[model samples]
Target: MRVETIFEMTSPYRDSFRIKGFRFGNGEKTLAIAGPMRGDEIQQQYICSQIVRRLTMAEQHGRISEGKSILVIPSCNPFSMNVSRRFWAMDNTDINRMFPGYSQGETTQRIAAAIFSALEGFEYGIQLASYYVPGDFVPHVRMITTGYETLDTAKLFGMKFVSLCKPRPFDTALLNYNWQIWNTKAFSVYAGCTSRIDSTAASETVDAIMRMMQAAKILTKTVTLSPAYEPAVVDESELLHVKASHAGIFYRLKSPGSSIESGDVLAQIIDPYNGQCLSEVKSPADGIVFFAHNQPLVFENGLIFMIRGM
Candidate 1:
């Protein structure tokens, strides 16, 4: 295992900031796994750490395939992580939103450019990603419907679900979208939650990546998937959005992975001062919950749950 600096910037206030990459095996570039670009993605960073550990043991045991190279960048924005901020510590900009970035642009853009440049030329790319809202996700592999995306490559991870998302207007600047445009097949893996770590989800995520590596000939050793999974390919149209009717304290009766029928009481909003039930949020369709808000407070029209309809 070799550790190399991918990008670095001198900081007058403190130590220099550096984005480092861990390399496994030697020869052609094969796979690149990136971790959190924002500071609050503790779960994302933790998953990437586990991936590094897995790769380390694989390399030490000579399980890594010959003439194959894999790189893992555990965290992209360490400064924000250290300070407990989500975006860039300096200007509060998101590193993720600035991709295939201009070197002469803002600080975050420069960082994005540097990181993206290093990730190019890989056969496959995996990002430990998180949702925008504070919530729990049913661990899955997410793929953008870019013209270059191939579902066959995404299924190699062997996760329980493959979410096919159509890129929004701003998605053009995201790393996953840019990677495909640059001729690199890319995937984003979400492991249940964002700020908090979920061990079961993390383990499942690691196992899936290893299984993919083995199947793709990046590893020579056999990898067995636990409990077995026949992943469901789900797109946005199959999802049912459940929102809160009033703003107040959120009391959830269901979580991600829960199965619910139509009219099921998913959650209730309580008046913050009076402790009175403001409104009850119910499921509109019979389906499995794909995502659920876990935060304490909810605003009117806030997303409470996303169910994949049966």
Candidate 2:
């Protein structure tokens, strides 16, 4: 049980903020958890911090057990966290994009190097994440590769579904790159989107983390997760891009987080000057609606919704 703070130059605008790591218990199976490498996904950092706070309380109250060590880096990139941005100010690069970081590379690369070096020989690494891009609040778990092992591991998180996503092998993504080098068991939990705090997504993420802790025997309390809610699990192959056909004022007839059927009137694009409808977008599949553009004005070829079939 130890706590360490690493301080170094992270960006040009300001000195590096402290990267805090907490080790709990004295178990042989060590776990490393990280969150919010991107500045935009600051909510994820908050989520990790909550977990650390709980674990710290448990340790102080003599609730933690023997033979298990857990290391949590609440916020990996503090510079971005301070400004609520997603990239380091120095090079404007996504920190998660720099993995297996180099000592002489870039700012983000150096932070990754320090974190990855600390993660060596851990039993499992869980990368915390949220949809930092323009997307809907969909809580999901992802793995870097396929095979039943990783799939099962993702499923154990007790989320609605696990997405089988593959990162480019040599892309230097923090999770994928570090996984390759350390070769320790790893998975990532993604919830909500950038700059928005979806309470449902946050709760689901907390539930997933508790489930993992129970599976690892780090926490003795028996956890009963809600029966998995059936979700529209669509592969990257099944994703239908609903693009706006005409430029006009867009009105969504339906909201995200709701089920829709094929041919349903999802939205209508109308001419601003005239009351006449310019174009109507209909659902092509029976699935859940996500990422509905609520704005009245829309551009041609703008993404309206992403429907994942049931």
Q: What is the C-alpha lDDT of each candidate?
A: 0.90, 0.71
> What is model 1's C-alpha RMSD?
1.2
Write down the TM-score for model 2: 0.85
- Write model 2 residue lDDT over 78-149, tens digit each, in one string: 777677666776578876777777868866777787877777678778888654336554567666553322
Best by TM-score: 1
Consecutive 10-residue window with the lowest summed lDDT within model 1: 221-230
Residue-level lDDT tens digits of model 1 in 46-139: 9899889988988889999999999999999899999999999888899998999889998999999999988999999999887777889899
Error (Å) of candidate 2 at residue 18 is 2.1
Clashing pairs in 1: none
TM-scores of all candidate predictions against the true structure: 0.97, 0.85
